[model samples]
Target: MTAVQPKPTPVGETFDSLNPATDEVVGTYAVHTADEVRAAVERARGAALWWEGLGYAGRAERLQRWKGVLTRRLPQLCQAVRDETGKPLRDAQLESVLAIEHISWAAKHARKVLGRQRRSTGLLMANQAATVEYRPLGVVGVIGPWNYPVYTPLGSITYALAAGNAVVFKPSEYTPGVGKWLVDAFAEIVPEQPVLQLITGFGETGGALVGAGVDKIAFTGSTATGKKIMAAAANTLTPVVIEAGGKDPLLVDVDADLDAAADATVWGAFSNSGQTCIGVERAYVHERVYDDFVAKVVEKTKDVRAGSDAAAQYGPVTMPSQLGVIRRHIADAVERGGKALVGGVDSVDDRYAQPTVLVDVPEDAEAVREETFGPTVTIAKVRDMDEAIEKANATKYGLGSTVFSKTRGVELASRLRAGMTSINAPLSFAGIASLPFGGVGESGFGRIHGPEGLREFSRPKAVARQRFTAPITLTSFHRRASADPMVARLVTFLHGKR
Candidate 1:
């Protein structure tokens, strides 16, 4: 494989995105400054007013048109993703397809999820009619990640738009072209307003977007960076939805179908070259079936390879710097008495890192403890399901997990400490539009799908109307002294016994 080299920018303030597979420049994008980002936010705020004025019916119509554009020009977007990220064309297409579904679901359900609805009025306020409704939060700033760039960022952008907010999105420097494509397509669907705008650059650009006077900021990246975003947004008290990294784990039970469990583990751990935030980074197997399960994993992983070819199941690590991290993780696991059952440190090359699996890695080893963000997994043995659950939940990151047991799947899934867990498969929650996807702990907070996602970008507005005259008018300053005693007596009669 050729070394993945990036060419430096010329005199202008621009950066080149290199295809990790071939070390070739894919595209050039401007390194937007903070002021430029704020300008974009200001523009977005104006666009949001026009967008919000459309109401749910009008907005949904436009969003559906946007989805049609995406579906129609999917091939162009897929090739763009492939050129930038070096993933297989099929993977790129799959991500884009999933993103399309999410947008469609969000558009269809926005009315029910975020529209005005009547709220309850209790006996004490019987004379008043109360109603609660969701109002758009104006402009939202989104900082997206490179891996699953299309699908992940849309999880926020689509829902935000569905909830009646304009968005200024900053894609990862590695995948700016994809972001540009999306913005241009949306413009075709809604030509009158800049409802969706694109900003291209690196972390500094993202930091600027966080500080921009956008109503909300949705970020997806490392936990440490999530903290920085939260702190920076604090300057303006801007709300944010943080979807950070994760060291997701998969637990195999003694009663699990060994063949199925092994297949799920291999696919979950190595898909997208293991750059997934919710991918299986670690595994815990019941000791009763440890040897068999490991054998199956080895067999299933043997035929898999990473390359920029159609036959390959995956491609190179999108971020070149991650190659070193994958190497160090394998070396550390070996130094700490772990055994490499598959490709070892040598599996990692300048571009692609072959599938590597480690066994018996110490719990404290960097391979098991940290997010490797590569196509490697550390499998450990547990005496029983209880031990498996304990080991699985040990990580500081609680993003996603998988449980492979027929009888105890739900029970075990409930016990796992994660934002979402698959009962019999892997990463299923991500495909289900109704399921809100996000993480807890170091993985970050706030959801980006389903009803929760709709509300995230909306503010609840409540209204109350006086239906008739009340016998007790305690709210009025001119209320008689006798009314206070009567109210006290009524309150005592209602709640004194309980």
Candidate 2:
């Protein structure tokens, strides 16, 4: 008998997550296969029934317990986030704190936002009683982004759970450890079943989850990947909420406080290594104060550094592949007559990218037009706020924006073509629990926060019942010849003046 060789292990059956700052292996995770993903969806389907059966109060009670667990073990969760994404411990803590707040908001307000409410029956159906309630969709697959892993994913996960739906989360391959930690923490509170389950792997695993017969898919990642996710979800006609890429901008008016605007610009552009989807990637300043604002920004960024130390302002780029894109954008800007007032292309290395401020760059430059997703910003001088608004709204991506103006703050903010705008502040919309967070254009559609977020993971269920016999029965075939003329007259009388 000939000896048979054992079958070779699949290429991506297992993988290790590495810390971007040190390249140290944080943990090893199994690369869940398509079959495994389908199995998870199946389990979630059953869990959804049980989870939904709990109703709003029961679900809120369990979610509150999970919130307590997250609050108590926040430090541990933040450490796990730091290890996987190379963010500072403080940044990790901030992300977790925001996520916990979202949980509390979703739990406390779910019943109010999604519970059944009486609806006014129209004149034609005055004798009927109508009610509407938001019902949870079963088995939501959340494909999360690595940047701000805890805050971003939980923005969808917490709200979905609060709305009484089971979730199957597939975090980025680089941040699987963080995903596992969150799932494990939730399991501690709701041990009866896997209400929130984690599946680890690369793009293939995420693709599998998209096609795993999920009722809905909430994806956060690049615009390119979001398109692919939509294509896959279309196979099953599953609805999706996509929080994709963004090329957000910050505007500085002449009447703005130069010092405060500069500080906001620096923090908005460099914090979290500028991996934020809503990070200020472009700055359009009024010509009257453009030079002064640029100088302030340059000076502010001088002390900022990226490293794996307590004193460093930020950490390394979470994904090594993004370094090349950062380099290309910087180099392209410089070659096209853009001046690097602070760091340049040379500041980017294999791991970390220092803060880079580019000025005199044309509107057509890659740094200005594309989503660089780096610690870099292009400062452009515009004649007025009109020009600034025009330039800020020029991009195909409009996720978030910032406006700094003493007098025209609200006016300018309302004119910007984006989903969320911060007035005299940086990223204020994201922290507010009641405001919806998403974007228009290439930033993708749908929301993940506030009352809209709770509704996004659910479907509207309308109930109509006959309270009494109507004088004219229009819905039925019986005795409807004269009812039609009466209904038309009623509608014309009620709406003709408008």
Candidate 3:
């Protein structure tokens, strides 16, 4: 007997989106209800059939057109991102450009990576011709974060679209305007098909998207929220890719370039007001160059300012609630013997957190353990590279790490337990379209961007065809007693000794 599933709930009328920099009302978006989410998925499901029918060539053409629109409108989208998330205009532009790269890469590579290809038949199945192909999962739900709003969400949305799946994207509540801008651009290119749709609301809207039973869900947010997303996705047996929060570390060995290490640490930790998922929240320095690095870092950090002004080096905190969390973390770290060389507890304002660097901080402080998600970093002096590695790996979250050692950069990077390691650069892994972006442990699972990103949006379909019949028939109506001994001998000859 079939069990009855409840009808989806209806979405609300409208919701307000606030500008993180000014706390001003930026835009009003429809609060998508469960019914709207389900309808979007159903419409996407229908559109996906036509889309997938287009195959790789036809779809790539459409994707290229979409890319043209995004490329032309990059500045406008950057404006929207700046208004919504309070990131500097340059940062927003850079992230948007990176997203464009992903769109182009996904479109260009989808056919080759996902198209049906012949695979070798093993000895046991030598008589069969086998092939594998990736099929679109139809409807994909994406819940994005506010930080790097364009780059982060498009990482999922573009790949899904290229893989022949329609998307129902729920952008971060803080940056729904940027989300709408993207949807509007795509709409201009693919008007006939509602291939990409946008819905906006708070947690309820996101929950509705999850319960809508989309083929898969890709989420980027905090670790605690990621667990909830997983729990919600489980109810419908929907697979999910979670690129949650991180407390990424940057390590400097004794033989490292102190100036370059300082520059990378400052830029990596303080960029975007330090609201990065893979931001360098912690740094472990070899005691030999510890003082030199700190001096250079402090000197460079002094020149950077956080504000909504045009010349401000950094922007305001995108989420207001994060201010309190950032403050609490700084206070806890300071109380635990950490000394803030720059901004401290009072640095968290209504809209921005000044770039802060702390030293002598305990490894157990909230600033080190928890994700501050602000422009704050904790620098610890370690006895050796072993201690640096130990302290770096001590965190529960392992997303990204940066190592600064000319001689042993690759070797040390290989030892760090992270999804990506920038040997001499900070956050360079994200810009490279070929590398996979994700994390391990509590940082979350699954990946988006690169070859893995395309696979995440599609399911592998396998096919096997029999060219000729062999004497040893395993699945037959008639019994073959002698074939069993022959099969055993073959298995022994192939693998028993090995």
Where in model 3 is the C-alpha error above 4 Å? 1-12
TM-scores for all candidates?
0.98, 0.97, 0.96
Global lDDT of each candidate: 0.91, 0.91, 0.88
For model 2, give the 10-residue run with minimal summed lDDT.
1-10
Relative to the unseen true structure, what is the Cα RMSD of model 1? 1.3
Top TM-score model: 1
Higher-lDDT candidate of 2 and 3: 2
Number of clashing residue pairs in every model?
0, 0, 1
TM-score-based ranking, best first? 1, 2, 3
Error of 1 at 267 (Å): 0.6
Per-residue lDDT of 181 in model 1: 91
Predicted structure 2, TM vs. truth: 0.97
User: Model 3 lDDT vs. the true structure?
Assistant: 0.88
Q: What is the lDDT of residue 393 in candidate 2?
A: 93
Q: Write the per-residue lDDT of candidate 3 for residues 1-498, one digit (tens) a residue.
A: 112111122245776676666666677778777888888888988888988888898889988898899888878988898888778789999999999999999999998889899999998888999999999999999999988889999999999999999999999877889999999989888888888998887788899999997999999999999899899999989999999889999999999989999999999999998989888999999999999999999999999899788899888777767888999999999998999999999887666788899999988889999999999999999999999999899988989899999999999999999998998878899998878899999899888888898999999999999989977998886859898899999999989995
**Candidate 3 local lDDT, residue 343:** 91
